[model samples]
Target: MAIYSSTSPKFFLSSASTSTTSTTAMSTTKKLKRYLELDSSLEDEIPSKKKQQLPRRTCLVCDVEKGTNQFPNHKKVSSHEHDHNVCDPCYRSHLENEIDSKGWNEVACPECSITLTYKEVKNMTTAENFAKYEQACIRATLAADPDFRYCLSTTCKSGQLHPGGTDEPIFRCEHCGHKHCIVCEANWHQDQTCEEFQAVRRRLHAENERSQQEVKKLSKPCPGCRVPIQKNRGCDHMRCSRCRHEFCWVCSADHGLIFREGNHRHEKNCIHYRANPRAQEPELPRHRIERMLEPDTRLRAYNRGDLDDSDFDGSDSDDSDLDDTEPWDDEADLPLVYEPDLILSEVRRRAPGQTLSRVYVG
Candidate 1:
């Protein structure tokens, strides 16, 4: 009645198109539901099947084809329009070998031979090895520098040196808290010039040699104790103060020789018995005795404004007017507290060009 024809071409075409569209929509909804269910249960199941399908990577060092998991600690190098990768173990081995053989300056990549940056090398090395590398670098730098000096204090032998070209002769060792002369390389000789100090040092050395020779000539060993003794003015019969064993000074024999008779006589085997009776020499003059006993007084006089330019040339006419007192000995009473901040500030004030970038305290 309403022109409904079963064989109509328009109606057949519209029905076919609608059926195709509905079927496709239903297929898409079912596929979406399946995907949601799979995703929801993914945590409970082993995902190795999916991971196995992932792309495999080739290690540049070992030339082995491995999954991404094997290169967990890989290092990347990008330079000169090229990219490179090294596995962790291989990178560490290469860095360590380079450091042991050629130091940090020659640390390089095994494949490309290009020098590795500090950050790349540091990441591969251990903490201890990194510290050693830093120290080696510093030592190399110091070795190259001619003006560098080491602190002479035995306790704290720091490698810090004061900047040169300053008028100040005295420089305090920041590590040991000891003051030293930069020119003479000794304890600070504040009062005397470097030349005067050197002259005094030479004279002292000569006097020491002469005194040793005099001791060898004048002194003999005790027979009982082996302690050296010089007979000033007494009989040849000697008693050792250390061992209290009496013996002859000339022949170094037992005291029985003198005990046999009240008179002092040398034994027959004594070296000086026949020609000389081995009597002790006369006592030294009072002035000579004083000079030998108190050599420190004359030695200290140079620092006390007592010794003048004339005394340096063997003229000892003027006596020291200053009292015999050692100022440096009082340093022993001072407290030894290490204040790093104070030392750093003081060093900065004294040497503006020097910079203390790193400090290690144990």
Candidate 2:
């Protein structure tokens, strides 16, 4: 048996494998170098082909290289370092968005933050957008102007371009044929000056306020027509002239409770009737009260033969002259005299069985 050392065989095998790997690597490297040298020689032998170039541009917005024609009439921003170009569509869109969001006053380029001139913006945007920008500018200018006035016509709200320091009170609308006073903001008053018109307006306002206060104080809506009824001085047995609906003034019910019949007889369940039983008593006939209070009126009624103590029913009297819907305004002309004792004595004397409990004089 030949005793061969294990270490020697292993070392020899390792050396052989290393040599093979080195040879393969050297061959691959040489082939690569030769290919490169061949490519360089070919380049040197043949004239370099002219490279074809296409007209191109870079869009600042999208950051894409597009054909130069794609940016026709495009916006450009020139700085010290470089010039920035934006495509037509992108530039128009940016202008429209800026005009819409920031309005005409603050419209600016999104890229360069440069404020665009009105002419530049108008040329870039659409017709509709340009019109909107123009209108916005007009509105802003008018708002800042102290002399600016809008037409008072509902059909046409066109602005009136009144020059500053013009003392013209009347302005005629060019859009609609309506003339109005600028100071009062009302229809033109040919008879009155601006000061007079304003004074009349103030007086009308005061009268309206006074009327409203009177309505709230002395008026109640009718149950049938819902029209406000003001009782200046009348019987509790109220009749709505508009709807012809009869009701008690004290109870506000459709019950037949004459004011002359006494307040307790009106409606026991009514809040007002229960609250003031004596105060809500039936009123005396207007004619009789007038006769008893005013001797001159009584003599006039007697001369006309319209006054009869026995058959003097208020319903029979001609109330055609008086409007039931309106309160009696002539109360100021009449004397404020309350002779309850005299009225009750007269009532007792006229009708023995018809006893008078209370009398309310307004």
Over the full model, what C-alpha lDDT does candidate 1 score relative to the true structure?
A: 0.64
The residue ranges of model 1 lying beyond 4 angstroms of the native Cα positions read 1-41, 44-50, 53-65, 68-75, 80-86, 134-149, 152-157, 166-171, 178-362
Question: Which residue segments of model 2 deviate by more than 4 Å?
Answer: 1-65, 72-82, 101-103, 134-149, 157-166, 185-362
Cα lDDT tens digits, model 2, 1-362, are: 13457767532336667788899999999999999999998887664342224467899888898866566343433221234377778878887888788867788765667687777777667788889899989888886887777888888868767664337777887788788877677889898887887888899999999999988788888989999998878667678889998887766876555444444555677654533323635555566553443344434554566656532322234423432222234543354454564466455655578544334343
How does each model score on lDDT?
Answer: 0.64, 0.67
Clashes of each: 0, 2
Report model 1's TM-score to 2 decimal places.
0.33
Worst 10-residue stretch by lDDT in candidate 1? Answer: 275-284
TM-score of each: 0.33, 0.32
**Per-model RMSD to reference:** 31.7, 26.0
For candidate 2, the lDDT comes to: 0.67
